[model samples]
Target: MSQQLIQGNEACARGALAAGCTFFAGYPISPSSEIAELLARELPPRGSVFIQMEDEIASMGAVLGASLGGRRAMTATSGPGFTLMQEHLGYASLAEIPCVVVDVMRGGPSTGLPTSPAQGDVMQARWGSHGDRATIALAPGNVQEVYSLTIEAFRLAETLRTPVAVLYDEVIGHMREGVVLHEPTPEELGRRTAPRAAFSPTFLPYEPDENGVAMLPDFGRGYRFHVTGLMHDERGYPTSDHVKVAELLERLERKVEPAVAAVPPERYRLEDASVVLVAYGIVARTARAAVDLLRREGIRAGLLRTRLLWPLPAPALTEVSSSAELVVVAEMNRGQWALEVERLAGGKTVLAPYLKAGGSVITAEELAGHVRRLAREGVAVS
Candidate 1:
């Protein structure tokens, strides 16, 4: 492992390169711009291609095209740029294109705050695209985790043959920390399997084997295959048949969610605690500190840090919330992930929310104080 002090955006760029990403097409946006800039500098030396697109939409489109052409591709953006890429993001999901998207979040809902940090894009990352689809999103709490999770995002995208998002707030994105970045093990790297029997007429582009992922041959690899955003059958052509549409939709979900159980949530002091805190991304660092301070103050407070935010890691969340008396969810947005946590908890525990917006962060002192007051107010533990 080589040790160096780097920002989260820098780490994400390095991680993508380490994961064998060969093509990048992205627009420059605040906080996320560094990721694109670093890739532009690093990828070329590694024999990779990096281009600054006309906009986020074109960036996403170019990424999908490159992925189809057999390159590990990615793009990075912030609030406005992410919003612009939503339609293409949906297309990638529907087509099952393997790519990674990095969103270094700033305050949102029409360029709320450009340089400040906020976790306002949680729900947008999951459901910004239209129609029914499943997305895998990962949030890293610290600089080192930013590196590791960026690599994991690429690996998951390849393994599931779908787009995976890596979300970080501006605070973490620009914050520099000492990290010893290590290379992925052979198993950690994604293996691109060649399509069986190239040029065979019997080949089905959307026909999933046991893995529920279609065996798609790269473009120009002797495989004449069709790719489209419209609902299609197993041959990859657009179709209006209800059964074919249902099958394709079902496979999209089946291929993504079931396999996500392997990605577990990060926990701290939750084995035996009356109060639990839920947080992710940069906010999670403060939550952890608050938990430690609460424990020292004789408050049985624990933390459940969500690294994998998309599938919601329901089983793990349910188990933890059911054991705690009060579950407090903290985010930079007003109850985005908190709402999801409440729905997942399903009345198993009391859900409380701590939200901040307009680019301000929730501090450890503030979180600890809230927990102490909540505990003192006698909010029945169990």
Candidate 2:
């Protein structure tokens, strides 16, 4: 465990290598191109494979192919590119393929800011694929967390056999800082227990257990099976029947959700403050600094930095929401996570957003100013 200064995006690339990633395929895009560049140079020489795909769509399809080939694979992209990959993300979900996706989110609807930072994809990462599936999006505020969280992303993807999103804003992605890369203990490493039939001459391609997770045969393992963008049965065969579709989709979602509570949650300055603040991604880092700034100025405030964005950290939220004088939710989007909190909220908690879609980073000073105003108005922090 040694400390080295690295950009957040580059840290993610190295983290991928450490997490046993053997394949990299992506179309280069702004703010995230460093990752592609780093992987391209490093992976091939190390016996891993890297390819720059023609586009984001093919980039994702290639990920599926690689993962099925028994490689821990990944892809990196910003907003526009992520949008193009959404269709295939849904396919990975329906087919229950395992892969990690690093979405260093930038501003967006179209060609929003190419180089600027924004948390606009918070909601998209979870609900983007045109269905009710929940996504595991890990938002990191700093470069160090970017590397550590990415390794966890890969483990979670393999654990539940779902595509996990390592979501970060451009601030974290572009910022340079010392990252102490992890050296996971043998016990901590979560290697996929590849089926023994892998060495057998013949095997069931989609053989599943009681957990509904099937043992996938990697592409070159001589285990041939069909995969598709359409809903598939456990056998990976296409199905048009409504019952089969519903069953497959439900299993796909539950294979993750039932135990999502075990996912890590980061609780910051929110221990005793009546008015709690909540934010994620790079925005959460700003929110924390604002918390400290407001405290020194005599505003009793705290923060709940959301690391696990998908499960919403419901119990922890309800606990804080019940006691706070008011709570403020901020993000790059228009109250998406705030809406989730509002539903679970148990008090007179108020929602305030220093929200913006202009493809810029929300500064600690900007958030502090809002806290000062709230403190002055006595508007309530519960």
TM-score leader = 1
**What residue runs in model 2 are displaced by over 4 Å at the alpha carbon?**
193-212, 220-224, 258-262, 346-348
Q: Cα deviation of 199 in candidate 1 (Å)?
A: 2.1
For residues 1-382, what per-residue lDDT tens digits would candidate 1 score against the true structure? 5689999999999899888899999998897889988889999988889999999999999999999999999999998898898898899889889999999999878978999999999989989999987888999999999998888888888878989989999999999999878999866767655566667777788777687888787899788989999998888888999998998888888788853565677889998888899999888899999999999888888999989888778887888778998999999997899998899899989887888887888999989888888877888342
Off by over 4 Å in 1: 380-382
Best of the candidates, lDDT: 1
Q: On a 0 to 1 TM-score scale, where does candidate 1 land against the true structure?
A: 0.97
The residue pairs that clash in candidate 1, if any, are none
Local lDDT at 134 for model 2: 50
Error of 1 at 220 (Å): 0.2
- Give Cα distance to truth, residue 84, candidate 1, Å: 0.8
| Model 2: per-residue Cα lDDT over 161-267, one tens digit each | 77888888888888999999887654344655455565443455455656666666556655667777676665667779899788776766667763346555567
